[model samples]
Target: MLKAMVLRNIKLYFKDKGMFFTSLITPAILLVLYATFLGNVYRDSFTSNLPDGFSLSQKLIDGTVGAQLISSILAVSCVTVPFCSNMLMVQDKITGARKDLTISPVSSAVLSGSYFLGAAVSSLLVCFTALALCLGYVRTIGWFFSGKDILLLSADIVLLVLFGTALSSMVHFFLSTQGQISAVGTLVSAGYGFLCGAYMPISSFGSGLQKVLSFLPSTYMTSLVRNHAMRGALAQMEADGVPKVFVDATRESLDCTVEFAGKTVTIPAMYAYVGGMVLVLLGAYLAVQYLAERKRIYS
Candidate 1:
């Protein structure tokens, strides 16, 4: 029965045309546009600052482009998955289909689990697809993720996908209409790039803005991905004997290791924060479900 429900939701998602495109369009456009326009601007700035006799401009440009694409992927992945995941719940409510199922012998637990699980799985697929597309974009810039890089990227995807699922679940409980979901979805999809540090480095923000964005998964997501994806480029620079000062400056400019409360958050700590957010958000979701169930029985 659980399997049936999950499969049904996945099938329905593909059956809808607009939704299928919405999941891909925002992220894809961001990746292509930013990498094309800003990638060169940053690359030019990056190359110009180096002392004379540095012939690494072309390679550095590729690396900067790769780094930007990684940022684009995170913005795309975080927003794409959650935006696509919640629609199942909204659709069931809007079409009155869940009412019939709720009246049946099925436990609310099973129904809820089915919907969340279905969304989780759907989001996972969407994230992986984004990763694959990002990988292709990364290659276009003359770089590729090594095996270890792929493994790390995969883990990041898993954690971010979980966070996205929990976020969708927790938020959907309050929203009982498709219109509300669409409005929120549109806003998030449109704004997440700015909110999450995808369009600009986190370091560029004012202290107050940084404090607020630091609490969001997108902020951490950007840091984590840029750190990992840019490793190859950084390593290349290191190998080319780029000065320590320049390397450090580049890393800081990209917001690879973010500082919060005067402490640097390493890649491991960022992963922990993301993983913790997943647990916290999912717990809140379960609590909301329990409360809603009790209210339904008593009312």
Candidate 2:
């Protein structure tokens, strides 16, 4: 029964053409823009910013383009995964399916697990697909993740997906209508990239704005992935005679690192940030779920 419930939601997500396509639209558009135009723009930025005699290498091309790809993926995944997950729950609420499920032999725990599992699986599915396609495009431009990098990226993605699922559970508790869901989807898809600094580098913003964006979990997530994604380029730049100071400048200018309370956040700190956010979100989601279950049982 648990397996069936999980499969049902996953199936519904795909079967509903509107939901399926809507979830992917922003990612597809962003991937195209990044792969085609932004990659060239970043490459040009490198050429223009560095010393006159600096020579380019494969890793330089990889770093400039790879940073954008990593940030873009993290931004889209953070929003889309949770949004799609909650949409499924909201659909169940509106259609009375959840009420039916509540009355079945399945316990509240199983039902909740199913919904989460369905969302995580589906969200991961779409994200993985997007990742593969984007990586394929970047590979042609001389940027590719090494095997070790892929494993690290995969772990980061799974954590983000889980965090997204937990967040969706909390949000879905409030979303009782399709209109509300649609409004959220439209707004997030249109604005999250900019908000998350995927469309633009946070480093370019004023210090005040940078501080504000740092509070967002997306900021840390992007920073974490961008470091792993662009580290090779840094090495390449160093090898090619670009000073470490200049490479650090490139990272700073690109929003690949963030500052908090006058200190630069490190990789370990970024991981801590993500981990802390997940715990807080999961706790809130559980509290809301318990309250909702209580109300449903009595009402």
Q: Which candidate gets the maximum TM-score versus the true structure?
A: 1
- lDDT of each model, Cα atoms only? 0.76, 0.75
Worst 10 residues of 1 by lDDT: 71-80
Candidate 1 local Cα displacement, residue 294, angstroms = 1.7
Give per-residue CA lDDT, model 2, range 1-299, as digits (tens): 88998999899998987777766665677777776777777767767787667667765565566656755766566557568755888898899988888888987777777877888888888877777776676676666457777677677778778777877777777888989898877776677777777777788787889889888988877776677667666666777788888888888877666888878888888888888998898778767777778888899
TM-score of every model?
Answer: 0.93, 0.91
The residue-by-residue lDDT of candidate 1 on 1-299, one tens digit each, is: 88888788888877786766677665677677767787777777777777688767575668666766665566557655666766878788888888887788877777777777777777777777777877887777667457887787777777777787888888887887867988878777777677777777878899998888777777888777777787778877877898878888888877787888888888888888888888998888888887887788799
Candidate 2 residue spans exceeding 4 A from truth: none
Listed per model in order, the count of residue pairs whose N, CA or C atoms clash below 3 Å is 0, 0
Candidate 2's TM-score = 0.91
TM-score attained by model 1: 0.93
